[model samples]
Target: MSGVPMSGAPAQPDPYAAPDPYAQPDPYGAPMSAPGGQPMSPGVASAPPYGQPMAGAPGQPGYPQDPYAQQQQWAGPVIPPTQGGGSKAWIWGALAGVVVVALMVGVVLYVTGGDDETPVADSSATPSEEVDPSTEPSEEAPDTELVTDPATGLSFAPMPEPWRDSTANYGVIGFYEVTGQVLDVLTFEDGSGWIATFVVGEINPSQLGSSSMTTDDAINALADLVDGAHYSKPPDFTEPLDGLERNEVEVNPLTVGSYSGSAMSYHLSWDDDSIEETGESIALGVLDMGDGRTAGFFLSLPDSVPDEHLDQMLEALDSLTFV
Candidate 1:
């Protein structure tokens, strides 16, 4: 038991043994994680694995060699760096942004229309001073010498001088005297020895279908004055009579101060001998006042009448106006 006797001595772990294959390499003398864990510096490539060629070195991965000559051999070709890959992406992104902005501006303009004043279209005739039909009187009324009627809506001038003035139903039908032989029935004979008269009145509603009456209707309504049985007298009478002669009569359309009416004429025959013995005639004017009303002037005169008397009668007829 001399050399082999070893029983209760302390077991000592060896400080130096075979190196560990999986342990980390030394920092000062070895690569030490390739200097901050980077393979190489900027523009510098790492040395290829132990047996591989170095970058950009002859007979390395970057440089090619001629296989038939003594030149060094290269493993493969390398690609050269170019502009950044993000350049195209940046250009496309800028174009897309411009399109979006333009679309936004167009939408804003369309919504607002960019105008403050809206256009208006006027499709009416020219404007004029309006005259109220219910309030304004007719033009026949002068400043001081005018008379107005409210019932029929008419205006009348004062009767002319040297002529008698008469009215039926308180001026409903006005009568102005003219040159002629005075009769008991309020009628006169003109210089031609024919009867003359004038009257104006609102048309009877029974005779009118509407407010507007035609000139023919107005003339026909007064037919009794010229061709009725009461006015018809034979041509062979010595004594004077108050009747219209049944002779040929002519009727025509006429205009009087914006009024349309009828003008009529006929020969008088009061004598009992011949139709032409009387040498007198009648002239009549009947005007339509447009609102179922009328104004008429009749003249009975010799074949030849004084110009002065005729002019005066005409002036009176021309003075009529309607409201």
Candidate 2:
């Protein structure tokens, strides 16, 4: 129908009337304005293109070819960006919340895991209790049967039927021995009870041997020796031994009869077990080696074990031959 000519002129219908989805102007590069933009009559300027509302048209809307369909405070089909952005905002907020939760978890793990101040560490702390000089040795005598060689002062309690006595040990410091061999009635110098094994070693009182010293100094010196630094008597962490503490260790001239040699006296106690949230200051006496300088070995056992009965240890130390 677009090619049909006008009845009056018999002229060809406008070839451009068939709407080109692309081209708009009449064979011209000018932007197409509106369909009714031209005059109603051939030479009369009546109204603007369909886009502009005629002054007298009273709210007549724009035409089909208008670039913008509706124009006012708002326009048509106002599709917002990405579902109105509210849902997107919620989604992003959830994602952010997850990230925050993850970060919080990470921080909690980092802060809580593997701190230096652990209960195990506190549990393992060495203990020191004051030696109760008042205690007397028990009437019980040494279990000489446990003695392997009385001549050499070397001994171990008699092993049970399947166990053996005086087994030679291998590897590491002052002879460390664990009785894989079945044994019972283990006894030491004090005859208090059977110990798993006896660790015999020596301490080398630093070049500064027995000089004038306070009891505290002696304790510090003792603490240092047990720390495996027999050659260097380092100062102890000068804090009171609360509960059970590995207090001080040191080499001192403990004269018993005519014998005077370097002895490592470890100050240990079961004070902590007796008190709540703390330990007592008590000593568990472990005597000196036959002839050597030592600070001492100390361990804090929570419970008491005839620790006050240290006469045997004192006797043994006193009996040691310094030569």
Candidate 3:
């Protein structure tokens, strides 16, 4: 009975052997069975173990219902971090470009300043044409004006335009030609019936300190000298010859344009040969300019002439100047 084997004895499995085929497959490979021997229905996906991607489960169509199952395949390629050294280099390069642009602008401004002489003509405006000098109206020279004699240091106002300079030498006196004079007298004529005579002469030095002639007498003598030289008719010295009557003014020392002198005035009346038949022919002003010198001026205006002309002559006499 010992060698033959006892019926119904329990046996232990070998330690290093493969699993029996009838036993259930490993737990990790498939779903576990239910208590009644029916397989369990699929369960919800659990959180993945740490540090692993969720690929899929082991069953039919693995993880078909999981939302993130194919997320890794769908994502675009990863971009490396653009944080420290390369980023700073790009910023510095941009700053350098801006500084270079600023320097160029400064150079341009310095070369062309705000006050440069370039004329800024308006493009929309019409330009004006240049004018010719010959076509412009010119000013005409005056007819009656002042005349200066440099040699004699004299300036005569209201001198006639038609009068000329004389070549005749009058012995220590300056002479000017007059168109209206038939005698060799220095006469001036205004076309409107006015005549003036001017005489300037150096005096004898002896005549200054001890002259026998009184001032009034000397002035009268100058008048007489002019009359005798111009109108000496030879019948009676002062009679019906023009029937002239004379009135004299007191003579006094005066200063006329830098020259110390004596001055006198005279009024004359005549019957016939009077100026413009007005019974008076002339008015005279005489100066004995003293550094041994003298000047005599005579003016005659027809009554037909406007009184303004006579006034002008008188004004000219007042404004005499010696250079």
For each candidate, what TM-score against the reference? Answer: 0.35, 0.24, 0.37
Question: Compared with the true structure, what per-residue lDDT tens digits does model 2 show for residues 222-267?
Answer: 3432222111111221222234334333333332222222233332
Better of 1 and 2 by TM-score: 1
lDDT of each: 0.31, 0.24, 0.29
- Candidate 3 residue-wise lDDT at 232: 18
- Clashing pairs for model 3 are none
Model number with the top TM-score: 3
**Tens-digit lDDT string for candidate 1 (24-110):** 322112211111122111011221110112223222211122122121111111111123421122222222232223323433543
- Candidate 2 versus truth, CA RMSD in Å, comes to 47.0
**Shift in Å, residue 310, candidate 2:** 4.6
Model 1: how far residue 167 lies from native, Å: 4.8
Give candidate 3 misplaced runs (Cα > 4 Å). Answer: 1-146, 149-152, 159-194, 197-215, 234-242, 248-252, 272-291
Cα-lDDT of candidate 3? 0.29
Positional deviation of residue 166's Cα in model 2 after best superposition, in angstroms: 7.4
The local lDDT score (0 to 100) that residue 318 gets in candidate 1 is 41
Worst 10-residue stretch by lDDT in candidate 1? 169-178
